[model samples]
Target: MLESLKVLDELRLNFSQSGLFILNLTLAFIMFGVALEIKFEHFKKVILNPVSTLVGVFSQFFLLPLITFLIAILLRHYITPTIALGMILVASCPGGNISNFMSSLARGNVALSVSLTAIATLSAIFMTPLNFSLWGGLFTEIYSRTDASGLVRPLEIDVGQMFQTVFILLGIPLVLGMWFNHRFPDLTKKIVVPIKRLSIVFFMGMVVMAFMNNFDYFKAHIKYIFLLVFIHNAVALTTGYSIASLFRRNATDRKTISIETGIQNSGLGLVLLFNPKIFPPDLAIGGMAFITAWWGIWHILSGLGIAGLWGRKRKRVVTIQ
Candidate 1:
């Protein structure tokens, strides 16, 4: 199994160009399946449940990034700016494309999952760059203030360019996915499941390959990366549930929001990391890639634990109430 994983990882790195294409295709196709299953009436119902929606949005769009920044700041004695920025980037990222699949598997509100993914993807075109700018900018200011001349410059980023890229890579695929559901329902249905399964495998391979390619560097960072990833993911899952419970949303909505907030599109992070203008080679993006990829596995276990615990608790309450 380990050997196979290594081979897959190598293929993933070699075929990343094609791997990315496959990933995009899979996201569009699965989301298209989700779109087809959505009902106008059900969608309206989700919208009407404004509390759940707002809490979810607040946690994802605002709270999580804030928490990540604070953690980075508190740990500034040990963590580097690159690691800090990496965590912020992942935090600022929107819901993972795989959330819909996991939501479906968990038997959560799949419709709401789809809608959140779609809206978040669209919103990310603006929010991602903006959030990063805010968090990264603040971090830069702080470091400069404290460290005197040794401080690194704030990320001089181009929000417009990023927005355009998101439009092409994320927004366009999303629009096309939704369109495919409408235009080619049968074909969409026939292939969506198979493609989703394949995408997961392909993506996993990409993660492994990324590690293999930079195993030495990744090994060095694994200690800190593990620490940050755990805290980052824990905050996400807890904040998601807290917001959900605060608003008294249904159990199903809680599950949806938790999964959506917890899973991030690490592939997007990888893309940004590789952009030379963003940073030099052997920069922090590799750490982000490795961390986020590992986080994905841990979160599956975490989400399942949350689900099972909820299921048992609800069963007992029902037996009494």
Candidate 2:
């Protein structure tokens, strides 16, 4: 498994500067769409009823990264250093923009979901870089002592560059979208749905293009990647639910918190990974790119699958009652 995964360290996906620009635009547009759902009331809701929100924020920004580090440590022999760092990067990302949709489908707390999304996205500018550097640095230090191969690169990140990228990609769009919504309520309502639908199509197209370009590498190594991502995603979802439940959150909050924590903004991770300034073209971090890209696709499937089950179970209970 480690030998197969090691090949990813030398691999580089075919993505042009133009393609990268488009991805940045698409992700920014998606963040804008997410902000359309964020009313001032979402922040107010979090402030007024902070328990569930606090639980979700804690689970996402803190516990999830901690758990991922522990998982990487425990599974060190089974996975490569790059793969482990990839998991850490994904964990450090904020909740996916689609989590609100999944929460609504699950009959969970849509308001809370939206609120968490807003908070998480805003928080990510600082937290993503902080968490990744903190955890990635620690992982490399610990792993360096165990491995004789010297594969682990010094985990260096330009915190200023990352903050700038995230702020541009997330913070600016968020402010603009919310302001547009606030300024033109009627127009915001008319365009939000179409913008969101278009954003999803564009993002998925990018992911498919990435896969097509790297089909051979993915085909050769997807089994290992698949299993790693599947287990990692499951642990994330379980951690969210278990923590929420431990805090005595109700079922609705539990479901929403779980979805929020589990569905990470891996698109952002991909964008960061592709940035020459942040990751640099010389870095052998293809494993991080693969993990981030696949997580973008897999989380949607897994989130929808779980949401569908929860939705059906709710219908059944209602019928029984």
Best by lDDT: 2
Given candidate 1, what's the lDDT at residue 20? 50
Candidate 2 per-residue lDDT, tens place, 91-175, comes to: 9999998899999999999999999999999999999999999998898888888878655456766778988999999999999
Alpha-carbon runs more than 4 Å astray in model 1: 1-46, 105-107, 277-286, 308-321
Q: Give residue 285's lDDT in candidate 2 (0 to 100).
A: 84
Relative to the true structure, candidate 2 reaches a TM of 0.97
Predicted model with the maximum TM-score:
2
**Residue-level lDDT tens digits of model 1 in 1-321:** 222222222222223456456544544443344344433454475578656666777789898889888987886656556566778888888877567766766657777787677667778888887888899789868876776444443576666666665566676666666676767779878877776676566656656655666676556556666767888888898888788888888888888888888877765665555444444442334334555566655666666676566667766877998
Full-model lDDT, candidate 2: 0.90
Off by over 4 Å in 2: none
